[model samples]
Target: MKYGKTLVNDVKTTLKVLVLFVPLPIFWALYDQQGSGWTFQATRMDGYIGFYTILPDQMQVINPLLILIFIPLFTYLIYPAFAKCNFLKTPLQRMVCGGLLTAASFGISAGVSFALEATEPSLPTEGNCQIRIYNPLDCNAILTAEPYIKNQDIKTMGYTNLDIPNVYGEKVVDFSITGCDGKINYQTGSNLSVIEKETLFYYMLPDSFVRGQDDIERDENGLPKIRTLVNKRVEDFNLTYSDSEKDVLNLPSNDDSLFSINPGSYKVQSFPKELKFYLGGVYTVLVSLDNNNDVQNVEYYEVTQPNSVHILWLIPQYVVITAGEIMFSITGLEFSYSQAPVTMKSVLTAAFLLTTAIGNLIIVIIESAKIFEKQSEDFLLYAGLMVLDMILFGLMAMKYKYINMEQNSDNEELENKSERKESNAIDNPTFKHNDDDA
Candidate 1:
């Protein structure tokens, strides 16, 4: 009877210890999803919804909701099935089932990733292109104008002609070329030569002309003779010959000159042709049009391409991470309580709960460090912290030993016996007291 009573007490104690550790680990595992799986999943989602952006951290609520809804169901339905199945009687069997489920969840997410990747943009098409062009101008506006010649003649010799204005409104004499309609006339007393008029259009000259001193040939009177007549009369000069030589001399003079001419006003007849160009296979010029009626200028451009696949790759990683959370966090809580002595069961449960709280606090600290700061660097720091945690957990696993309640009974009994002895000594004192005095 005593043996049966001790066995029943041992079972009760084991159950009580399991109860403390079991819930804490589960809660920890559920909480850990916020950092791992949820975080990874959120990277793939459109955070913005009609100008209302959803933070990745806020998605963590899903894990807690799942826990709240499923914990009781598992306790009532799934736990009973494990107990009745006989095949899953051992804790290792239960752990294996949990691991398989976790892995299966990850597998499902991997399938989702594959599907997402299949839909991802592979080449430059609509929805993935970004192109922006600044202000555009007409090509005709940049073309230089052709040069021409003009001439004027003073019929009476030795009389200065004045008030004659060039096309640019500059007062100057004019020179003309003797062409098919006009012939050169030379007299014995004074010979006449046809001179060319120089028409100045838009021209750009260097500043060196302004910096240097004027170099001109002078007559015996010390006054400079006109080596180049800007605008002069062809009839006033003496001509020795006529032919291509005279025509060559009549050509407009080429000199470094600067002047602003009115731009040619012409209505653009058609739109500019699109320039078909490619920037990698993933990016191309989609549509371009000259909306301004300037055929030489492109006023509108539209570039398109497929969306990126980076987000698709993140979802599977999230699921695997979430699975790890279930295994390490929830299972660790169960293990903590099961290993603890009956007297310290509450402390073990608290320890299990503390790990999750610490994980959450670490996340808060990391986020706070970036509060009011721009995210310039990649999130490698957070990744490093996770790696550190995994390493620490692995080290702990190496040193950890499962608690065996059956073997710990002697220690519990010793503690109980010591307590009973102390209590008896306190109740029945060996020394003579007030009764002996009476």
Candidate 2:
């Protein structure tokens, strides 16, 4: 320790690193949302790109994949250009630039979210009910419901959405579908009790099936719910799960039956045909007759549109955030190691990592407090916070003295030696007498 001279330098270096830790957790809090907030965002968007569909959970892979590509690109090409321009000369500058990019990425996400809010459909308000009809038959069908929706012609395989506010709750209403030149005149006065803020999906199937009882249970995890309404007698009805589990499901003829299953791809095999189910969905499948008026098919419809905003909108945000990570995350670690004293390198690294935990804690606290009304607003708030954080970090960096540990150690050794020589001179009476005579 050179009689504590080196220890002073080491302590100072440690304090500087600790100061850098202040703004770091905010970055981590925003970055770690790839698993939670970002995934939830993907769920509201459409995952279809060409023929392949991307899952919301799979979006997390974009970070690591971009890291692999960005590491080399920055190391070999991008950083060199910046170096030539006399830019980002220090690790601190790169980290600041990276933080700005992080803020920019979230800004882009906010814009996408605003677009989603505009394009996506809204749920029925309190005391109001929404309904959509699906016509799977080949012939065009005319739907009629007095005092709620006008007589509209729904084309073959097309659907129409209607919103009704307090349409005689628990009271029966006359609803009819006419097609096939009036050969198919289906009428019903059943009380389709579509409660307030609930969506009822009705499919006009060519089968003699009665409306089944409604199962009122809702899933807490927000997983998908599937309900099968058997209109006719069918055999070998089953659901084939992607996780290699198959169950022989049977719905009593002309009754409402409900079943809950995990979220994944599932194939429903029955007498009519096969239908595939997606994740986090609420679906109702009705067994019905084909255009032949003979029971031979089943159709399923969802309560809400699963993918209205395309997943591709997320790509730009992901790219920007990944680039920022490549610049900020990697440079921060390097700076922490290089500036730390040799004996405390590992401790500073651990301190740098602790910022991530703190960032997550901030998120948990704010979420529990319900500080924001909308997620877009929350994102904007984070972006704003990050900007302020970067400003503070940049100011701190300007004051931080970048030191070479080896050079500092040598200087400390020289200072210690000089101090010892001065002490010896003061202690020796002959040296003091000679100095006094001179």
| lDDT accuracy of residue 31 in candidate 1 | 37
Off by over 4 Å in 2: 1-3, 131-162, 166-195, 200-225, 232-282, 289-295, 415-438
lDDT values, one for every candidate = 0.35, 0.71
Model 1 per-residue lDDT at 280: 10
Task: Show the lowest summed lDDT stretch of 10 residues, model 1.
Answer: 203-212
lDDT of 2 by residue, 1-438 (tens): 354766776887799789877888999888988888787777766665655667777888888999999999999999999999999879999998999999988898888878766754476777787776666556787777665666778876566767788654544466666663543445544544455667665655555313333332233333456776543344543333233366545444433455655545554443535555444455666555443435465566675444467777898999999999988999999999999998789999999989989999989987888888777888898899899999999999999889898887788789989988977874556554556677
lDDT of 1 by residue, 56-147 (tens): 45655555555665566655776678678674444434444454444344445445445433543223122221111111111111111112
Query: Candidate 2 overall Cα lDDT vs. reference?
Result: 0.71
